[model samples]
Target: MSAEIWTGVRERVLALAESPGVEKVFGFPYGGTPLEDPLTEEELADLERYCGVRLPDEYRDFLLHVGAGGAGPTYGVFPVRRDADGAWQWHGDGGDMTLPKRLAEPFRQHVNPEELDALLADQPDEEAYEDIDDYDTANDAWEERLFATLWSDDHTVGAICLCHLGCAQRQWLVVSGPERGRMWDDARCDYVDLEPLGVTFAQWYLNWLTEAEKTAGTVSPSETR
Candidate 1:
């Protein structure tokens, strides 16, 4: 689907989530779209067959609830609503769900920019080793280390899935961990470091979505399903 379609779906989903009777909402930055074919049992089976990976139960339930919407190629969905107490609720079909332990922990601690800088600066200057692929090469050792550190300490950060976009030279961070995930380009990165936007995951998602809308323009209602 086009960018316009995803925007409209996102707005609708957010509205539903904030409406009464809704508890909470969640979404992904990328993967599938509202315009794409609704996920079916056969499709799920086919995906597993082709991908050779068994999706986690929580993720499966998430897909069943919110098919796909947002900026990325495939994403989760949710509706935003207010609770009786006047607090906001991120309501979705899937009830309280837990993310994998491996993916949680980073959000508990602040991302240490000093540590990341030190790690990145200490890397040895050398050619790529055959044993380690490009991602594992010393050049990216610091980034991986930072990500691993965040992943191990906080469960919230772990929920945000990481994916490389475009070519090696130009890539972006896609944060799809908790409520209303979105793709974060370089600008969003700035916001994460400066603003008090909740947890790292929430800040990242909101920053990315806000920037994406500015860059891509708003989606019209007619484009939504």
Candidate 2:
């Protein structure tokens, strides 16, 4: 069933690639409609072993059947590659956030609203500081501390940063706990909490593909010529 689903997906991707003026689509400069090669079973096994957890079923199947990653939602999926020493790692902007060692742990979904509110409320007030230089120093320090707390890895355990959406935005795929197999929007870089997209890997990817095609259709045919 997974293979069949991937086949249909590949077909859609191909169609999208063949669309007129595909080069003008958003994120085309980065991905160019090319998918990386699929991973072998041995490679997939090694990746799972290294992470100490089995990947979600649909994603695992995608790595096995479809290309490992490429030309996906937004800027495209981050591609996993092996080094000269045969160590596997995902490569792309913001990919480092996916801690493989923590993949087996349950994703921590509980964010303390009170704590977050308090942190925001603690922002340094420029009006309170009489000296301009002193206000700058205090503001910078406050921002540093606030960002550190909000971007802590404790909030994203058991997940992988799947793709970057530019402007410091990204998405994650949970591999363990109740949210396993679902996608989450990572807007923490914008000081927002992560929100579950409420869609599985396949659904998320396919939806993007559909939207991409629709975007392509909106281009005037004369423009391509």
Q: Name the best candidate (by TM-score).
A: 2
Q: What TM-score, to 2 decimals, does candidate 1 have?
A: 0.30
Kindly provide the TM-score of model 2 when superposed on the true structure, using C-alpha atoms.
0.87
Per-residue lDDT of candidate 1, residues 74-106 (tens digit): 133332233465432223322122232233232
Identify the runs in model 2 with alpha carbons over 4 angstroms from their true place.
27-33, 218-225
List model 2 lDDT by residue over 1-225, tens digit each: 656667656545655677785776554325344777789999999999888999998998888877788888888888887778876677888888888888999996656778777888999899999999999999999888777777878888899998988889999999999999999998877777889998999899877776777778743232345
Cα displacement (Å) at residue 5, model 2: 1.8
What's each prediction's clash count? 25, 0
- Alpha-carbon TM-score of each model against the true structure: 0.30, 0.87
- Cand. 2 Cα-lDDT: 0.81
lDDT of each: 0.36, 0.81
* Model 2 lowest lDDT segment of ten: 216-225
Model 1: how far residue 151 lies from native, Å: 6.9
